[model samples]
Target: MKKFDVIIVGAGLAGLSCGLQLSSKGKKLLLLEREGVVGGRTSSYNLDGMDVESGFHRYIGYYTHLPRVLRKAGVELSEIFMWEEKIHVRVNDEKPLVLGMAPLFGMIKTIKGLVGNRRYLSLKDKLSLLPFFMNGLKDYVMSPHKLDQHSIKEYAAKYNVTNRAFHHLIVPLSSGVFFLPPERYSAYVFFGLLAPTIPKFYKMRVGAYLGGMTEVMCQPIADQIIKNGGSVRTHSNVESLVIEEGKVKGIRLEDGQVYRAQHTVLAVTLYTAKKLLKPVFENHPWFQPMFQLPLMPAVSFQIEMTKPAVPIDVTTFAPFTCLSSFAEQSRTTFQASKGRLSIILSPPEKFLDLDPQETLQFIIKDARKIGLDLESNILDYRQVNHEYDFHSLEPGFQALRPTQRTPVEGLILAGDYTRQPYFATMEGATLSGLKAASLIK
Candidate 1:
C-alpha cells in the first residue's frame, strides 16, 4: 500500500504542469499515467533516426504558460527558437494572407472578407467593428465574462461580416485554436486567441524546442516530479475510480491492484472521466448533464520525407484540405539532420475516412497545392486519430463542463478538457493542471 499527499493522473501537459507546481512545494505526489510517456498530445516519436511530433505545436511566448513551467523545471529559454513574424494563411478562393506585425494593415485584412460578402452585412454593420478592432483587445480582456456565452459565428454575424471573413480568417484562426468548427464554438474561444493578436509587451514569436517537444518539455517535468519525492507509474491502466462514502478513496487498476490517495485528479478525457467516475456519476444530479456535452474529435497525420518537399520555411495556411494551418518542422525530424524533410498534415473529417494510402495521397496532393514537391519525395508516414482529443464546446456547452472542483470532495478534474479559457492547447492543459493542484489541500 502506498499513500500520497496528492495523486495526479494522466501525464499530459495539464498533469505535468500540476505536478511541476505541486512538486516544487514538496508535496508527496504520485503521478499515474496509463501510457509509458509524459507528453500527451504534445509529445513526439522516433522513426528511422527521425524525431516526428504528434502534431504541429507552436509556442507563442506571450499566450502560452508552458514557458513558465519549463523555466521552473530547469528548461532554458534560449534552448527554444522564436520566430517573431512567420504566420501566413491561404483560403480556398482568396489570396494567401499574412498575419504579421503591421497594425493598420492587419486590421484592414481582418475585416475585409466580412465586408466583401454582399448579403451578410450592411455598410453600417461592417463599420461598427472598426473602433473595437483598432482599439485592440483591452476592453475585451477586461470583460471576458461578457463574451463567454457568445459564439464566434454570432459575433461575426452581429458585425455583418461575411462567411469569407468567418471561414477563411476567423474560422480558420478559431479552428486552429479550438480544434473544432468555428460555427459550433463559443465566441470566448475566439476572443481568447485574438487577445494576443493585439500588440504585446514582450516579443511576439512562434517558438519550438531545440529537441523534440517530448525531450524538451515532457521529460524535464517528469524528472522534477521524481526528484521532488513523487512517484510516477506508467502502463498502470486505471480501471475505475474507487469511491466510498461519496469520496474518492483510491483507484482500481486493470490488474486488480488498488492505490489509495487523499485526492484524485481525473485528468483523462471527458469520456474517460465519465467512465471512471461512473460509480458516483450514476446517482449524482450534475453527472447526467455532463454526459450530454459533445466531445470534439481531432485527427492528425505526419509524413516523413527523405528529401525537402516544401521550399517555404513554414506556411501557416494553405488552400488545400480542411486543414486550417500547416507548419514546416525540420528541427525535430532526425531526417532533417541527414538532408530530409518532414511535413505535418492536419486535414479535416473528410480525410479521416480515407484509407492510409488514400490519406497519404490526399496529403501529397494538398502539399503540391502549397508548392511542395510531394511526388519526388520518398519516405514513410504515421497517423494518430483520437476522438477525445478535444471536447466539442458547442452552443450551451459552457454550462455543462465540469469545473476544477468535482462532485467528489477528494477528486478534481484536470486535462485540457476542463473549463479553461483556451481549448485543445498545451496552454489550456497546463492551466488546468495548475488550477487542479491549487484546489488540493
Candidate 2:
C-alpha cells in the first residue's frame, strides 16, 4: 500500500484545484481519476480535426482566482483572448432581444416592486436583503447567510419580480450558469454572484480562449500539478474508501490495489460522492436523504462547418425552454480547413427525453429565429449529454448539500454540489476544490 498526506478522488477541475493548492503548501498528495484525462467537463477533445469541449465552458475576467492560479502555474494569460459578451433572451418565442448589464428595465421594475408593495419584498425577507443593497451592498458577498434559507425565485416573487422580465432575463441568466432555475436556488448564492459583477467587471467582456477551454485553462493547470510534486493518476477508479475509526485512511481501487493516505478528498459529482460516502453515512437517515438532492442535465451540439456564410461569433442565452444558455465559438485558425463553430445548449430537465436529432432540429430552429444561419454552412456534428451537470437547487435545497468537512474525519467533500455559492460551472468547481484544500492541516 502506498500512503500520502492526502488522496484526492476524481481529478476534475475541482480535484485538480484542491490538489494544486494542497501540494503547493508542501503536502504530499495522490490524485486519482476514473477517466484517461483530468478535466471533468472543462477539458477539450479533437474530434475529426476540430477541437471541441463537452459543453459551453468559458472564463470570465472577473474570476480573479482562475487567472491568478493559471499564472502561478506558469501559463501565459495572453494565449487566451476575451470575446465581447453576445447574450440574448426571447420572451414567448418572439424576436430575440439583446440585453445590457443587469437588464436595466427589469431591474428597475424589481426595485420598484421591492419598495412599493409588501408582496414584492416581505417584511422579514426585506430585512435580510435590504441591508445588503442599502447600507451593506458593497460587502454583501462576504456574508455566508444572505439568502441561506430562501430560494432565489421565492425572493423574486416576494418582491413581485416574477414577470416576463424575471423569467426571460433573470431565470435564463441564473439557470444557465448554475443549472438551477432562479425559482429554486438560494438568495445567498444569487447575492454571491451579484457581488462580483459590477459595471467595471461586466465591461471587461465575457472571455474565452483562442483555442478551447482545455488549452487555455485545464491542460496548463494539469502540467503545474505534476510539476508541484502531486501525481494525477487518470483511469484509476476508487472502489472503496478505507476508513479507520471513522477517519479516512486510504482508498481501494477497483483493480485491487490499496493506496493509503492521511486524508481523502471526494471531488466527484454529487451523485458519485453520495455513493462513495454511503458506507460511512449508511446509518444516518439524514445523509441518505441528502444524497438525493435533485440534479439537472446539460446537452450541447458541436457543429464543424464546411464553409462559413454568416459572421456570428458570440455567446447567447435563449429564454424559451427553461433552457439555460448557448455559446457560439469561432475556431478560426491559420491551418484550419473549415470554420469550426461550437454551440453549447443547456436544455431544461424535461427536455432530456428528446434524442440528439430532435435536439439538433430544435436548436437549429431557434438559431434561425435568433438571426443565425444554421441550414447552409454545415458539415459534421457532435453532441454530449451530461446527465449530472448540477443538483437541483429548488426551494428547500439549501439545507441539503454536504459541507467540505463530512461526518467522516479526513474524508472531505468537493464539487459544485457541495455548499457552493454557485450551482454548477467551472468557477464553482474551482472554488469548491479550493475550499476543500483549505480544510487540510
Candidate 3:
C-alpha cells in the first residue's frame, strides 16, 4: 500500500488542473488515469503519423479561469491557439451567413456585423429577439435559475421570437454547441453562458488549438505537476473508492493495488462518477440529484478530403443537419490535417448505432444539402464515439448539478457537470477543478 497527501482519479482536464494546483501548493499528489493518455475528451491520437482529435473543440473568448490555469502551467493562450473573428452558419440552398466581430472597430461595427445579415434575418425577426436578449441580460443579473424550467425553444416561443430567427439563430446555437436540439436544451444554461460575453461581445473571438491538444495543453500541465514533485500514473484503472466509517480513505485499482490518500478527488465523467459513488452514496442528498442528471453520447468524424471543402478556418454550422459544427483543420490548426474536415455530429442519438460507413453516408447526404460535395472528394475518414460524452443540460437539470464539495469529508467531485456558471465547457471543467482544490485543507 502506497500513501500520499492527495489522490486524483482520472487525468482529464479536471483532474490535471486539480493535480497541478495541489502539487504547486506543496501537497504530495498522485494522479491516475485509466487511459494511456491524459486528456479525456480533449485528447488527440496519432493516425498513421497524423494527429486526430477526439472531437472538434473551440475556445470562447469569455473563458477566464482556464487561461489562468494554463498560464500557471507555463503556457500562453496565443502560443497554442489561432483566433477567428467570424462565425459561419450555412442554410440549405443559400449562401452561408457570416457573423463578424470588429474588435478594433468598436461596438458599432460589432453590432452591425451581428444584425447586418439582412439576407437571413428580417426586421420583424430581429425585433422579436429583443425580449429574449433583454431577459437574458436581466436574468444574468438577478438569477438564471428561474428560467431553468424552460427549454430554449419554449423560452423563445414564450418571448414570441419569430420562427425564422429561431431556426436561423437559436437552432444552430443549441444544436451546434451542446449537441442538443433547442426543445431539449435548457434556456437558462444557454443564456447564462451568453450573458457574460455580452459586455465583451466585440472582443469575443473563438480560438482553435494550433496542434494536438494533449501535446500543447494537457502534457504541459502534467509535466508541471511532476516537476512539482507529484506522481502522474497513466493506465491505472481505479476500481472503487476506499471508504471507511463514511469518509474516503483513497482508491483501490482493478488489479487490487491499494493507494491511500488523505483526500481523493474523482474528476472523471458524470457517468463514471455516478457508477463509482452509487454503491456507497446513492441515496445521499448531495448525490441523489446526480443520479437524475442525463448523459449524452458524442460522435465526431475526421474526414480527409482530396481537396479543401471549406476556404476558411472558421467554424461552420448547418442547422437541421446531422452535423453540429465542422472546420477545415488544415486551414485552422494542424497543417498535417490539410483538407481534413473535423466534424461533430449533433443529436448524437441518431448515429450511435450506425456503423462508420453508414454514418458517413448520412453525413454525405446532409453535406450535399448544405452545398458540400463530399461524395466526389472521397479519401479516408475516422469516426470517434464517446458513450458518455457529456452531461445533458436539459430543462430542470440546473438544479440537479451537485457542488464540488460533498458530504463525505475527503471525497470531492470535479467535472464540467458540477455546479458552475458555464456549461459543459473547458472553462467549466477548469473552474470545477479549481473549486475542488480549494475544498482541500
**Which of the numbered candidates is closest to the native, going by highest lDDT?**
3
Which candidate, 1 or 3, has the higher lDDT? Answer: 3
Tens-place lDDT per residue, model 3, 1-441, is 999999999888899999999999999999999988889989987766556888879998878888988999999898999987777889885788876643643455457656688989999998999998898668756876778888989989989999999998888877788888888988887888788687766558888888889889999999999999999999899999999999999999999999999999999999899989999987788788889888888888888888887777878899978888888888655676548898889878888888989999999999999988888887888888887968878887787888999889889999999988887899999999999999987
Each model's total of backbone clashes = 3, 8, 0
* lDDT tens digits, residue span 1-441, model 1: 777788777888998988888888888888888876778787776745545666767776566577788888888867654343446665433435555432333445334544454333456554655643543254356755555566767767766665444555565566664555656667766666667645552455566445677777798888988887788787878888878888888788889988888988878877788778765678777677667777766667666666554444454655335445665555432325423343334435555567768877776676566555565665666666665666765555665666788766788889887877666678888889889988975
Candidate 1 matches the true fold with a TM-score of 0.84
- Residue-level lDDT of model 2, residues 275-379, one tens digit each, is 787877778664765677867666666776766423454555655543356544555321153555555564455446777577768767766655666677777
**Candidate models: Cα lDDT each:** 0.67, 0.67, 0.86
* Best by the TM-score measure: 3
TM-score against truth, every candidate: 0.84, 0.81, 0.96
Q: The CA-based lDDT of model 1 is what?
A: 0.67
When sorted by TM-score, best at the front, the candidate numbers are 3, 1, 2
Please report the TM-score between candidate 2 and the true structure. Answer: 0.81
- Evaluate model 3: give its TM-score: 0.96
Q: TM-score: which is higher, 2 or 3?
A: 3
Q: Distance from true position, residue 14, model 2, in Å? A: 1.3
